[model samples]
Target: MAIVSTSTSAFYERARAGMKDLRSQAETLQAQLGSGQKLTRSSDDPVAAARLRTLSRLESLSTIDKTNANRANADLTLADSAMSNMSNSIIRAQELATQAASTTLTHSQRAGIAEELAQIHDDLYALANSRDSSGHALFGGNNTGNAYTLDAGGNAQYIGSNTSAELPIGDGQSVTRSMTGRQLFNFTDANGNDTDVMATIKTLAAALTSGTADPAAAANDALGSLKTGLDTLSTAQTVVGTRLAWLDVVSERRTSLSELRSTEEADLGGTDIASTVAQLQQTLTVLEASQASFTKLSGLSLFDNLR
Candidate 1:
């Protein structure tokens, strides 16, 4: 009788422990199904967890790269718009100079044209010092201040850096994000003279208004300088357009890399739904059977008949 009682107690303890284990297994499977992830903790799968960490780091870097690319693209877009306006202003200056060069125009008429040229110069100066979305000078070249400033003599001066700013868009890859005033507005003319567009316009305006020399000759010289200004603008536009195209290419590559990282992460961390569900079902069934058997065994006592 003693041996039988000891055996029964051992059976009950073993059955209870088994049910507890089954319950724990069921919970694990349920959590995985709900979360749709196989490895919640590092202990769940060490190798897979390590791989996920790496993929996450790469994904973070990709996000940063994308942001930088977008910012660079936006700054370049602003620069392009400003350059377009500058081109239009230069063309208008050409027309005004042509009119002034006519022997038919009077002194007052020539002075009036110079007055309009001065306004265009002011507008170009403002445009050159235009700000980006972040309020930094668009052509400042790493400077947060204005790209061009007016001197005491009213000449437009380049206050920005010599080299334009660059942004990193990928691993070991960078793109020019800004232009310098020196590159866009300060260019050499056909005569190899270092002339700023605004300075040239100012000089021409003063010459036209001076009334001391032949207005036609002054107008002709200004027209040549304006042509040089147009060429310089065209070159800058080409450079900006090329950079924009390069940004597109880099963006495409970033998207592709992002997709690859996502795939790798899914393969490493995602759950096997079908297999997990089957395991949960099996655990539930075994737990229920064990509970029913334990209940029946607990009620069957040798002392019950004696009572």
Candidate 2:
């Protein structure tokens, strides 16, 4: 009722070995595909997978921070340029006012100077409406698309909305990216005096061109007002410089923080390829040997007949 065969025993043993090899090969292939790295995956080591995910998250956070920093830098740059142009306009007006103050200039001469001053006022309006690289007005306050428009009476008046958009640069830091004409150039001075440069230019132009012989006394009065307008422009320029300095400090800190985040990400998620490759090779060798042994043992089993 019983039969003894070395071939049968070897056949059973070989079948078991082949099954184990098949399972191992499947695992190795799965690991290779999953890791794509041939070694670093959850199946290979769960701890490494968790750490890699953490690193990835850190990297993403760093990218967001970098974006915030870039916006801050861009906004500050735009403000700086706007202030510089306004400063130049102020200086030009100062020169004209000084010339007008001189007694040697006759009525005709003062009228000519007033004509030029009108052009400068228009130019200043254009500068105040200047836009940034993003198509938003640099001086329009809060990233408005349009700048100040002249009223029916040729006064500089703003058409943009009232909201001031604040940009965030992380850690509760914020900055307003724009300023309106009303806030800067057309504001009331410490003495509650109106110093709208456009208004001053219009008034001066009308008076000088009226053919009044000895407009010298009136021109002298305008010099003080011109100085007031100059002060307003200067103050705006100073604010721009201060904002730029703050942005510079923040930008420097952001760069350093980004570097630290990069290092943390590397430590958390980076792979070690050398050890992974060695294990893959060993699994392949074992699989090949089992396949070869199974092929030879198939002939010796009773379940098989060679024709």
Candidate 3:
């Protein structure tokens, strides 16, 4: 194409010169903002950015998993504590029943023991209905709206499920946070054994409160209930202890995993201050020199001295 000599050419030249300088300034500013560090996108630094993006996603997932782990941990601890309390309360009731069963004790003394046993029963009922943080039933599992309700016969009925709520802890690992009242306090061990205990204690108490055929049967029966309950209580306590131990191991692993993930996140997302600063300074120097040279070249005119 033949070159056109008109104001259009001059304007084109001026525009091109301005655009070149503008482009240079933009690059300098971008370097300053980035501080020589690249963004986590394949377009920025394909290989590094891709790797960083993957790492960042993994870290995000791990963070969510940690939160889930924490929730599960809280629920499990609550269940463990509730189970422990039930074990203690039942054991105490058993002791009182044993005392009442003793032949050496007078009828009046047996009555006192029955009264104490009654209080223990009441306490057990309360513990069965225990609530956790946020007012959910601690031992009610996922159906935390209510813990224990009474049947028509006034016996405790578990209103929860067997499997406790679980939370994801990352890497395909999950943990259960809680067990319902039925699972922890009112299973075959807690409920089945307790039935006989109540029978024995009630019979003894009634006999002592009112004149009965014989003082011996009522008291002895109550003592039998006590012995059975103790055995059951021991088993229940061991379950709680085992669960707590598992939770502790998981908790330690959680802590270590968290620290490891944090370090990985730093590697993926954190800026390298020294390298970034140096790159920024170098770009600034080049931009300044370019601008000065462009200013001098653009200002030069062949006709200035002659005019």
Candidate 4:
């Protein structure tokens, strides 16, 4: 019969390796409990870690979308308020025009109305050149300067871009930040001639105060253009309101998506506290048992047994 022999040193080495492995497992569980995460390193769970990275990137993009949505909301709100003021100014101008069209009014009275109309025109010009929250022209599209500039003849000229800049909100969606001055203030008059609200008011004021042959006729003629301009303003207001409502819907969707991502992130990377605690207890118990067994086995040798 052939006898297989194991050395004492080899036996102790084997026992140490086993106990060391158990200790390492216990430490890992303890670390997981302390960190409140299942993974201390990507190597611990490569697939889960990769998914976490993707979720984190998505979360960052969502944050950017939220910021853009907020900015768009602010810019649109400013536009709506400015339009409201312009509408009021236009209504007041209409009333003045109605009074001026009456033959009962004296030349001085008509001149006073023209002065008021000039002031309203100035106000409208300023409103058209209003600045946004970022200090850029609110109705200037992508232009950094004033939306409407005064020409050599004192006429308001739109120098802004034809289209507004678009801001990305999220999920492949975008929104136009604002409308250009030309979009809001300029329109085709009843005579099928192209003119803007400010220019119509300017021409009417000039005729009334500049000793024209028929001031009342000019005032009556401006009534039709003023009505058309008011209608254009109303339509523009409605468009802005619609955009604001759309933003609200997109905001709700973004919130829902954000919540979903949070839930997914928790499910993917969050530790299972109770199960982890139980596992840690079991591993510690096994490690302690192994250590005790190794100590006992190491102390046992031929000399100790003989003694």
Candidate 5:
């Protein structure tokens, strides 16, 4: 009798442990169904979890790349617009210089034209010193000061850094966000002499108002310089266009890569609702059977059987 009682008690304990285990499994399946994500714990699926971590990191880096691309694009766009305006201003200067070159124009008439030229010079100076969204000089490379400033002699000079600003758009990709003042405005004339558009216009204005005996000669030289400046400006614009095109290509590639990472992450981390629900059903059925068996065992006692 003693041996039978001990055996029954051990059986009851074992049955209770099995019921608890089934309940725990049912709860886990239910939680997985609610969360819609399998392998909540690393132990559930280590390989998938590791892959998911890598994908998540890739997704984060992709977002940063996109932000850099947008900033670079915007800065380049601003530079392009400013270049167009500068080109138009240079063209107007050419027109004014052509008029001043006529021998028939009197000193007074040329002086009037010089005033307009002076205004154009100021406009070009301001345009060259344009700022970016962050209030830094857009054409000043990494320098925060104005790109073009007036010297004691009233000549426009480039005081900015020589290098253009660059932005990182990807893991190993970068692009120039802006052109330095020297790259866009300071160019060489046919005589191989370095010339800046603002200074060229200023010199023309001085010639018109100088009352030199050969004012027409100075006007002719001014016209040639203007032509050289135009050609140089066109070349710079082309460079900016090329960079913009490169940015577009980079943006497209980054977007495609981001989408691929997202797909991979979903495959690794996302749960299968149908399978989880089926598993929940099986767990609940086992748990119910275990509970019923446990209750029956609890009702049976050695004393009752002995009676």
Candidate 6:
């Protein structure tokens, strides 16, 4: 065989470089174990890192969607409760109207019933102007002000938008956040004339208190319109209930999607502890062996070998 020679310094340099590489590998594996992440930088796994970025962005958007859904849920729930109260008030008004329609009641007694009806009108107006969880008008649609405004004649007029605001709930879906006061309080009467609950009640109260030729006739006339108004209110309540149920479904879907994203995120970046620890242990063993060999070799000289 031909003689091959390497200088002591060159041999030492080669050994040190090999040891340095082994130590770097060991440190990398140790870091993976400590941090519980497979990637130290985007360059480590560009494809996975890009996917992770997309997932993170989606998570942020989903958070916003959840918040919006919660707000819509709260607003709709408030509207439902307020409408229930309104229904109760309408039922009470119907009872009073029945009492006023009786010819046996004295004029003073009919006047007392009219006073109660007027109070019910005021109560209904307050309910129509009920505030949402955010302190905004519940039945005002997107308007920040009261849903109904009082005119010079003391009549309640709808001042809100025709339709409520829609909120995004994720996956390209949206829901109307609330119903407008006009939708609940206003309806077509039996005579084909457009009328509102507040106006009808106000007129009936006035007729009763004014000592008209026939107070019972006025009360009888209002009964048909009040019944129609109550039907309208009940229908609106059903709509609100349906929307609330839809929100619940959307929320559950969002939660499932979020869980799926989390699972994908963990799969993409999370470190395998058992595999990383095994690699670290193997690297340390090799490094220790190399170090011991270098120490023994460096201490020996040609003269000492001969001796």
Best model per TM-score:
6
Tell me the tens digit of each residue's lDDT in model 6 across 137-254. 8999889989999999999989998889899988899999889998998999988999988899999999999989998998999999999999999999999999999999998899
lDDT accuracy of residue 55 in candidate 4: 85
Tens digits of per-residue lDDT, candidate 4, 1-307, equal 1222457667778988987888888888888778777788999889989998998899899899999999999999999999999999999999999999998888899899999999999999999999998999999999999999999988889999989999999989999988889888889987788998999999999998987898889999999999999999999899989999999999998889889988887777777888888988998898888888878876866666677
TM-score of each: 0.91, 0.73, 0.72, 0.90, 0.90, 0.93
Give the candidate order by descending lDDT. 6, 4, 1, 5, 2, 3
TM-score of 4: 0.90
Name the regions of candidate 6 deviating beyond 4 angstroms. 1-7
Worst 10 residues of 6 by lDDT: 1-10
Which lDDT tens digits does candidate 2 get at residues 1-307?
A: 1345675677678788777866776676556555554444477667766766775686676567667667656765776677677767767766776787788888779889889888888888887788775778766666457668888888777776554466776667876655566656675644578667767766666667886665666566666776777777777667767776887787788778767766755555443456546666777777777777777865564446654
Tens-digit lDDT string for candidate 5 (1-307): 8998898889878997888888888888787777877777988889999888888888888888888889888888999999999999999999999999999998899999999999999999899999986789999999998998888988888889999878889879899998988888787876899888888899989988989878888889988889888888899899999999999998888888888887777678776788878888988888888888778877876689787
Which is the leading candidate under lDDT?
A: 6
For every candidate in turn, the CA RMSD to the true structure comes to 2.5, 5.1, 4.9, 2.6, 2.5, 2.4
Q: Global CA lDDT of candidate 1, please?
A: 0.89
Candidate 1, residue 186: Cα displacement in angstroms equals 1.4
Model 3 over residues 201-220: C-alpha lDDT tens digits? Answer: 44555666675666666666
Model 5 score (lDDT): 0.88
Score residue 163 of candidate 5 by CA lDDT: 92
Stretches > 4 Å off in candidate 2? 1-55, 61-65, 143-145, 161-163, 187-191, 211-214, 281-307
- lDDT of all predictions, in order shown? 0.89, 0.69, 0.63, 0.90, 0.88, 0.92
Candidate 2 clash pair list: 141-178, 141-179
Worst 10 residues of 3 by lDDT: 182-191
Order of models, best TM-score first? 6, 1, 4, 5, 2, 3
